[model samples]
Target chain A: MRSVVSILDLSTSEINELMNVADDIERNPEFYRSKCKHKILATIFYEPSTRTRLSFESAMLSLGGSVISTPDSKISSAAKGESISDTVRVISNYADIIVMRHPKEGAPVVAAMKATVPLINAGDGGHFHPTQTLADILTIRRTKKTLSGLTIGLCGDLMFGRTVHSLIEAMLRYPDNKYIMISPNELKLPEYMREALDKAGVSWRETESLETAMPELDVLYMTRVQKERFFNEEDYVRLKDVYILDRDKLKTAKSDLAILHPLPRVNEISVAVDDDPRAQYFYQTLCGKQMRMALIMLLLGII
Target chain B: MNIDGVNNGIVLDHIKAGESMLVYDYLKLGRLKCCVAIIQNCQSKKMGLKDIVKIDELIDIDLDVLGYIDPHITVNYVKDGKLLKKRHLALPETLTNVIKCKNPRCITSTEQELPHVFKLIDREKQIYRCAYCDVVGDNK
Candidate 1:
């Protein structure tokens, strides 16, 4: 069975195909209802996640498919110390497809290897979140009107932000995509990522100030400083409030600049900016569900 | 200091100096019952100093491990006091259980039965990263 453990698992043409399906789903939701009539989707979350779990559930529901979920790990077999492989093998019997989120990076990879059905990695520690990249891409495609020839700004915790890493991987496949990575030196993008960008011959620059890169961005993807990924509380405390995207920051950005966040926001994004026309995070959430729907169907051979 | 030539075994030559112990440990030569000789810090015209390992009996050697440790090392197979073949090493495309990933957040940290897998990501730099977490493996 085909599974999506990383954003790289899908080719550029496949991503375009998924985006097309997502767009169609958004336009005609009723027409695509009952596509997965008798199929079952199992969301086995080893970590607490309201947004992603709900998105998968809603996507399955919209497709007229059944869902079996473990919303919290503390209550699941994982808390009893069951291995990801064993749990996934068991779950594969009950579900046609699986979407998982775990605190350990590569947990979903292990799950995918053992799963009899298609497995989707919703999030795996700080590794990959391919579906989130799909959602981000769909959002960028709709808002920016094109995936190429745009200055994409990735801000905040570039190091621990799985979404940022996945986005960079996905965006580089397109042509003329320049990345303006904004973050403190401590949270700079990993050397491998820099190497990938260099190998791809993509133009990218690093900066400590978001305002410096704001004006040139067509799409600005903001990420939270993940405290769980940090080794100590002191470092998390110091870096948490480093970059706040307030109205003042928006004033420096282009009017057409699309600000996107994989939400569950803290003070990193001022609430006042939510009302700004440029803010597309909420719309990004909607796109997330649609993309999940597209992905589920694609993996299940329904599309 | 001279070590006898192998009649029907393997001779590992041109190991970078100071890395012979690593090659021994990785090859698990200490576990073998066969006679194995390790010669270290020998002067050379090409290399300033090098190490050599000679085994008196034919034994399976993990060439990938040796290559990963040092690509310049060469493996000489001997049979009936004659050199059968000389094998050069290159960075392996992938390694399974050669080294464990140090990332605490990696799945291998919790899964006891999982094999530690790393892929050669940068051939020029000889960098290997964990297949699962993409964290760089400590080549040292």
Candidate 2:
């Protein structure tokens, strides 16, 4: 694909090919550090962000590429009502590739249409975060050393957790990847996603109880119940602390079980678990940078 | 039991019962200067009961909207009181600007010029999701 607007734009082999590149970069950092020597990476963020914006910038710098960025659209010309298409059209002239995050679900898609340079969607509202999925898959592949033959429990905010949605979709492409959806009934995944799993022949079951599903899981992907996504604060409050994972909860899980989160987390994961070797969220954060590196390299044909 | 046929016009047949007026209003058949006959809950051999919209003037009709509204609709072209062409409708694989995307955060919401596109994800369930954000559309 010329641009990565969605994870579905990538295939299983291409996913692996990128992982291989990320793996190599991890092993030989100095050798590949100067690969994007003369290139420019632009980060266009129309929404407030932390990890994703920093991750893309960090990835670009690690590749020895320079970056031009709009970390906040409020401060940019967008505040004066410049269109995303016009913004992308202007930015494509200055950057070799664009990594954009927007509060609107398909804003990057609109950017991808207008961009001459390749576009990478860092996160587009509650749509798809393909690069985050890349980090997720990379972390999962390295931690478990395989993408298949495991049960992954995606807990909390499944309804608005785009990462969970993207991760489930990406992981289902592999052989025998089972999913256990753990969430309150109010936050169950959309019916279409369940139907998609059914059509794909991926085995999955939904449960309200995390403790019930904990022992069987090989991986637990925890997501924050986002305050901004809620139309009602009461519903968010009721479901927010529904599944706080503490040491007591981890006692039932497998010893090698990997805990992953797309970070800047609110207490979905107890900081107590951060000390546990099973907590791979920090490593996943680092993988976020490496995966973006591999992604930029792939999109720019540096690999 | 013969319903009067139209000459040099269009006939929408086999529409789901009680949906003719919505179709009539949706297609904006009121704008037609010529005779427009809307026959609802008519006895049909194939469908048991159906709705028919007969336009006595040849006006541009959106087959996609008719198909999207009800896949079982049959569109017939008539000239000189003889049927020239007839076709049945099926659910469209993709739709543009037919239904507003329900997701508040969807691209179509903020990007006012963006086409609200949806792709049919489940044929049996007649389910369509917004192409941009994967938010399921109201298939109603």
Candidate 3:
């Protein structure tokens, strides 16, 4: 009866349980191969997304569940003016669970309200994306072997990076975790998130210099500096290359430092750094699948 | 000044004149199958002009709808030709199951079966936020 609407909805114990499940899935893949057996996962994506959609599909398929999907709503019944509720109602009858991604905020919440099956919000406009937060947590846990006592440096696009907000919210739950937010002044984190962090007693500092925070970071999470988010071309041009992680930038960073990026990178991360032992973005992608599998199993009541 | 009394009925006063039908439609008073009276463009000392809706049955008024349409309306409950209770309806704290958000990209706006839920996050500011998308809309 529970729905994955926001990261805040999951208690610390529930998140730990999900992480444990993800760890087990990573260690013993064969044991969970048929766990989902005859279950069906319905994916209703209202916006275009390649990685998120594919990850959900791959996760379900690997867990022995089939997928019923509308990859493009524009060409489907939605184009003819069918409501999201009607779509969810029809799909709910066919699928055992639903994963929804929409351009509008709260679209998945609406779907969850109408759907008889458990609903998972894949991504909703600039709002929450709980699954991505799960993936990031899994990656951080696997890399650091512990969530506490680490300085996590979040670099680039703080304002528009929905992942940054969710990650910040999740990380604040752990002890002795400090955040070093690196972004251009124009792309600073929203005041509300900063206030929330302040209220939670998490120590954080905002800075434009990535190199100054690089050496102290246990994890450096980089987000793409989206040009579209900028108000003008001049602003985009001036700040686009400000935070790119090159070999020169890595010289000051710790040897044990792990660099992570939610991918589809547009030159923010130099290709040369991909071979470094510290590069964990690709591994994070694999972790995304495992975490997603854990989520699907838990939501479907198969685990 | 001549106004007749009604037995076991509710009287709504202080509504902006000519807006009784909007309040009636917003409340869907006709669907209740109750005897209803809508008085429009009535002169008032405080409001200068006002409207009123009198219903024979005691029913819970939708305060969010009333708050959304016109916040100034006051509901007066009558019992046996005497004023039983008088209330000025206030906006709900958390609006669930009513009032669709106008944002096209809002999840509630697209979802057909889900009840449109909005929360009155900022009452003084007259701000209602969609429970899903967190988009803020002004009641005014």
Best by DockQ: 1
Candidate 3: which docking quality band? Answer: acceptable
Give DockQ for candidates 1 onward, in order: 0.79, 0.67, 0.47
Off by over 4 Å in 2: B1-4
| lDDT tens digits by residue: candidate 3, B1-140 | 44556688888889888888988887888898877888778889998988878888878887777766766778788888899998777777777665667766566655565667777765675767778776666444
lDDT of 2 by residue, B44-76 (tens): 998899989888977777877788888888899
lDDT of 1 by residue, B15-71 (tens): 998888999999899999999988999998889999999999888898999899999
- Candidate 1 lands at a TM-score of 0.97
| Clash list (residue pairs), candidate 1 | none
Best model number under lDDT: 1
Report lDDT (CA) for all predictions. 0.93, 0.88, 0.84
Q: What is the lDDT of residue B76 in candidate 1?
A: 97
| TM-score on 0 to 1 scale for chain A of candidate 1 | 0.98
lDDT computed for candidate 2: 0.88
lDDT (tens digit, per residue) of candidate 2 on A220-242: 99999998888898987888899
Q: Is the docking of candidate 2 incorrect, acceptable, medium or high quality?
A: medium
